[model samples]
Target: LHPAQDIPNARGTALIAKVKKPYTEDPASPVRERQSVGIYADWLPAPASFGDYDQFEGIARIPGQISWRFTMHQVQEDAPSWFGGSPWTGKFDEISSELTVNTLVEVRPFNSKTKKAGQAVLQGTLQRCRG
Candidate 1:
């Protein structure tokens, strides 16, 4: 989801999204089951130049931890090689600053005997490191 506003001390805003669904059941264990769910993050950086936009996105499974990182760059668009070419053709840009996210999620499985669905808890922190 979108943030209320751009984060202070951060180049731009960061967004997060999550989805949950039923996972395949284990045939070996009738009582044990898994849940299908994931959390995703998108970090957008402030514009470095006119029409210059950069962003990073990543996903991690529930009940686990993962890290996401990305670097920003500023590139110059090149002239079209042929007629009706896209404007994205350009020289590679120099790497700029980088962003990193360390996340942890804990998921409690559903209790089939009790007929209760599971729950998930998430914890994480974001850091802007040197490029």
Candidate 2:
């Protein structure tokens, strides 16, 4: 077995990306708009910067004999125009004014030493949202 096998098996790595939940609130909004979420994985460095709509693009890695790459993005919004003036709305407006991020995830394997000892990486860009 290689690091790739050990990382997820014996070593065991877990990652969680969290954002403030208040940014997705609106009391009278009925439409569900996109929310940007900032994703931070384990053992990886902070992203240099995100692009338009808080779109973050690059390689996210696990950093081992067999590595994986990933890309992420995020955003936030109060409520869409379509949700303007509605009775069946929740308190999504009272939510904090923060960017709601939408992160896209993708994965692929990379083999260096041998085909059997291949690695996997996740990559993608974040979608934009209005706050």
Candidate 3:
């Protein structure tokens, strides 16, 4: 069953951290880093059934049409220093450049091994490739 079926009132994006290239001792090439992405929403209604989780799944057979997308870098654990300051350690322009929103995502629910009730998590593997 779809995650939405279990959580009708759910709303939120998935914060993903994509490691482009593994940092190794090889210094020939510049270290390739995965740029962070961010997805924004005015408000994310709490999940109906899933505790502390929101839906992030979309219909199958679509590309780049995620139900919700979020870049972990976009989410700041600490508040910005100033009103216009960057959430991350970069210039305002750099921070703004890292934001990205994907409309394709899907989530599913199943019995939680740890929790007493069922759990909701992402359905598919989300990955990013760096060239």
Candidate 4:
């Protein structure tokens, strides 16, 4: 069975992860809180150079697998004025515990010089943090 097969409403939830191998790899944690699926200003900073974010994209079940995807211009010049994605982009597989984070940041205004942009794929995973 898959890792999150037993998790209730597992899709689209914010998870707390840890750095398994510095910035290059942020291994998945375990299933933890599901209600905190929004922005947390004082949350724990990610130990990776990929940099953390103001919010997390909730996981979603795709055609054959589960995935969480987010982008400002998944199309082209489509994003609004004051709304968009985070600085870090990552993937989490609850079953395999394989979370890969790829950061391609472009903060609003469609294309801005202040935005640090690049699709640098860093490897990692996701799970609940153990206290």
Candidate 5:
């Protein structure tokens, strides 16, 4: 079974506040192994507001890869004020209300030698991690 099989088409963006270092279960293995990374974020909806904040902590894993880049942008509720002389400046401030999260993930087989990807399987549950 593979990791990406069960992930339904998820849409919308979330604010990622923290990203942990990538770790693997079998660290001593010579071959490529699955690496997991922890991410803490606040998921917001289209009309993002303070009242609609949902705190979430998720783990994203990539098989056979040591490192990967994930980027997140800060979305503020208040729009920045524009000064005179700027193009189309007339107290206009509505662009900051858009919700977006652009992430591109490429998953490959654990065995790098194989050109095709293996069967995709989705596993794992969203649970609260307590101290």
Candidate 6:
């Protein structure tokens, strides 16, 4: 996107802060190709600078493909300010929705244990990764 061009939906490409979780397993059946598991936060934008994250690694890009990617903190609480600005702090422990529509998202830090959806926020940010 051109710098001068207006940001789509008043923002950049949406961001998803996904920390790959352990593969789902089933003891009753034989082991098979495990499905990907994750704990994530959606719509958090990339910081304007790399210095924003708690840790830093080099950013790279494939010549043609979408090579840009950033590793997130294994513990979300330790993440940088860019995770979801300040509003989203302490709200993410588990996310259980596909989030196809732009609307409030329920964040349940204890959902894994309680099996419930907690309070909803405007998903912190609907647009993401502008930087």
The model with the greatest lDDT is: 3
Off by over 4 Å in 6: 1-15, 23-88, 105-131
lDDT of 4 by residue, 1-131 (tens): 02122222112223444332323244553443221112111111221223433222323223244444333212123443243322323333332333333312111111123333322122122333332
List candidate 1 segments past 4 Å from native: 1-6, 9-44, 47-53, 61-131
Global local distance difference test of model 1: 0.26
Per-residue alpha-carbon lDDT of model 5 for 41-98, expressed as tens digits? 2222211121222221122333343224232233343543243110110111111121
Q: Over the full model, what C-alpha lDDT does candidate 2 score relative to the true structure?
A: 0.26
The CA root-mean-square deviation of candidate 3, after full C-alpha superposition on the true structure, stands at 11.5
Off by over 4 Å in 5: 1-109, 124-131
lDDT per model, in order? Answer: 0.26, 0.26, 0.31, 0.27, 0.25, 0.28
On the 0 to 100 scale, the lDDT of residue 47 in model 2 is 23
Off by over 4 Å in 4: 1-64, 72-120, 127-131
Residue 77 of model 4 has an lDDT of 33
Which candidate number has the best TM-score? Answer: 3
The candidate, 4 or 6, that scores higher on lDDT is 6
Question: Which lDDT value does model 5 have at 16?
Answer: 21
Please, what is the TM-score per model?
0.18, 0.19, 0.25, 0.19, 0.17, 0.21
Better of 2 and 3 by TM-score: 3
Give the alpha carbon lDDT tens digit for every residue of 1-131 in model 3. 12334333333333435445545667664555564333322122233245533332222112543232222122344654342312111111111123233223343322233323223332322344232
- Candidate 2 lDDT, 1-131, residue by residue in tens: 01222222111122223333433367554543332222332222112211112122223222232222333322232552342211110111121223223332232232322322122232333343223
Displacement of residue 21 (Cα, Å) in model 6 is 1.7
- How many clashes in candidate 3? 16
What TM-score would candidate 6 get against the native? 0.21
Predicted structure 2, TM vs. truth: 0.19
Pairs of residues at least 3 apart in sequence or in different chains that clash in candidate 6: 45-129
